[model samples]
Target: MPVRRFYKLYLSPSRKYVKTLKNLLGFVPGNLSLYRLAFRHKSVAQSVKKGVKNSNERLEFLGDAVLGSVVAEVLFKLYPYKDEGFLTELRSKIVNRANLNQLARKLGFEKLIEYDNRMISATRQGSLLGDAFEALVGAVYLDKGYDFTKNFLINHIIKSHIDIHTLEQTETNFKSKLIEWCQRHGKDIIFEHIPNQEGESTKLFTIVVNVDGEVMGLGKEFSKKHAEKLAAEKACEALGI
Candidate 1:
């Protein structure tokens, strides 16, 4: 494709995205093509050249690294007295899969991703939106620079979206906390999955958390891990730990 014609074709239709990007990032994008590529999920990726993959996966990887570096720096500066372990834990909470997915949804990123039409289910879309968010970070880094990317993350994402205080108080992994409590109190903990007769299509797992031979909590969720986590949360509330 000729450069001028390609620019006209892509730029014309992408005016709305350009405006949206400007509003979101607080800067006009120098390369709109990079942003467009960032929004293209692997499921709908096209081959731009022979034996080459044109998808957001590579960008996602880069973005993940960049995000980690920025977050680490922010945490280090924000909590100067804190130990390395604390900073690492805080960074994990901030960049976890569930948190990123929620952030992407809250920022209206789901509407911007170009994914496979067949995979339009809610769970799939949520995952894609999170990946696209990472890819967008990569695109910002490429279009702007490291310093600009860091500033954008600090000003737009960290200060705007994240509540550090609330995160400090939040228990991201209830199950892990409960396990630690159990270990400290010298109690044996076990999670048992109750079989569901609701057939394969609608099967839901019911998890029972037992501490020292006593059932502490029971919970049901679509996945066993989630069910166990919910049960652990209930157990925590019941035990007041």
Candidate 2:
């Protein structure tokens, strides 16, 4: 076994994050800028004043794609005998918001995020964690390269953290739950689809769900399933169903 030497690194919120870079990855970060960028939230537009044009939103986008690709590749190689559908579901379990949020919480990334006072409210707590997690992944990729990113994800995020078996058994299908609730209450739910424009996306949908001919809820999403589900979920809340 190689000798392991411990070194403490100071970070924001007066916290100490142990740096095992020299021991675990054979190098220490020469630039902390990238790490800072990883925890940045777009809500803090002041990064532009500091000459950083883009916020971590772009990084989050890139990280999301990267994470999906890596997770899919790992599942594919690990289960060569499995079918595509199984792989897709497995990938979903691995990359879901809840799973990612759990990872962020476990990593204690809440301390690293830079957010405005408006976003610090209790309701927005989960949003910060999710964004930081994606930003961290993006930061890791930039700082350590693809191989290190892959290994860190598999070793730290996947193998040691996420429990695949429990996730597989858990149901996050809000739409299904909403439908069941409606059925139990003997209420006929109907979703009306209307098209709308959101930025460059030409294809957008607005859903109005009616319960007993009354407009109980409204929602918007990029897909029919998402729109319907959102509307259904809103309806569930409105009716207390």
Candidate 3:
């Protein structure tokens, strides 16, 4: 087939891809071309043209930055009294890959990705779905504006889906809580790591958590701090401290 004919054929499918994405997003993705580009796997692009750039990497970049900004804005308004560190940690928790993956799955984004074969499996595992979700947010921002994106996030992602209280209680930071408990009780806590003479892929470490020279807990893990925290958590459970 002639090169020009092949190029024309390729363009034809692109239009259909755009139509699909518009329906998927429940809005016509502006610069629908960008959304199409977002699903194009790098391998597929390479096969088609050596210099051809596809893949959602660029959109992911723009989306990542845009997501960060939007999250920051939301957090600021939600927790006006929160210190920067608290807000930062909360934002990190809210926008982490796992959280985004959950949202993507809920939105059925995995089916929208364009891949050859290998990328499809990995994409189905939620990485690409999450990336495309972020890219969709970026596209929405560019298409509509910040307010629309903000409302979309709050209405669709935050309010409708996320359970704030459950998230807070389940994944509570044990280390921070332990430290705070000790401080409140006027107790000095020390974490001591038993020496590991040999290193291994999963090396065992002994942890002894002492409160005012009394051994409160002991535990073991593949790492020192992890063992210590586990030991401390056990102590917290036992001592109710």
Candidate 4:
């Protein structure tokens, strides 16, 4: 090991954390603070500034983007003859909240994450696990680089844990499921197309799902229908449907 990494593993105050990460992630993190921050839930976070808190939300956002890009590339190469729609659906299945939640649990995120137990129940902690997983991805991207992050994701996470062929056979119509649940509950659910931000691409469609006038979920995609489906998938996860 290099001198810096050797110090972090053997002599640093965060040696225990570093060792744990190595066991969990298959590599030692250079920036111990980023990985630590990644596992911190906002419920226990203290505000570092007026409105900013030392939480994993920002890292989650960055990791979401990075994860998407890597997944897209992998799917593209894996299914060269597949159409855009087919690829998109498969990608969504792989990166869905419910799926990521399961993956995180399998990887033992429950032991590493920091949260307020009083505020979040064990059943409701899956989302927190998913968020932490993404935040960890962001930390890896920032600590290493795109190539390293991609390779790590493909080799350590995807190839080891995920079953792509099984996912392809699984049909999860979250949109239909959400609609049926809403009808059964007598809740007014609406899928609305919203205007994009100034810098956002014109070709991209943003769909927001609202239930009883409350925003349930939001999704962005090149196809409006796909965006609505994505939003409904999120809504379904939020409602535990």
Candidate number of the best lDDT: 4
Candidate 3 lDDT over residue span 114-227, tens digit each: 767765554245556677777777777777788877887777678877775566556645567777878977889888876755664447988888888888888789877788
In the range 119-237, model 4's lDDT, one tens digit per residue, is 98765777898899999999999999999999999999999999999999999988998998789778999999999889989999999999999999999999998999899988987
Model 3 residue-pair collision total: 0
Best by TM-score: 4
State the displacement of the C-alpha of residue 61, model 3, in Å, after optimal TM-score superposition.
Answer: 1.0
Higher-ranked by TM-score: 2 or 3: 2
Candidate 1 lDDT over residue span 1-241, tens digit each: 6665455445767767767876677777778889988999877887777855788988999999999999999999999999999999899889876678889888888778888878576435667777888898999999899999999999988899999889988867789988998997789999988777556445588999999999999989988888998999889778755
lDDT of each: 0.84, 0.70, 0.71, 0.93
The alpha-carbon lDDT assigned to residue 107 of candidate 3 equals: 74
> Positional deviation of 2 in candidate 3, in angstroms?
40
Preferred candidate (lDDT higher): 1 or 4: 4
Question: What TM-score would each prediction reach against the true structure?
Answer: 0.67, 0.63, 0.60, 0.76
Local accuracy of candidate 2 as per-residue lDDT tens digits, 1-241 = 2222222244432123335333332345544566677777777756455576556776787788778888888888887898999889788877866567777877767666777768565545666677767776777788778888898788877887887767657756766766676676677867787766557466677889887788988878888888887887777667643
Candidate 4 all-Cα RMSD: 7.3
- What stretches of model 1 exceed 4 Å from their correct place? 1-13, 174-241
Off by over 4 Å in 2: 1-30, 47-54, 176-241
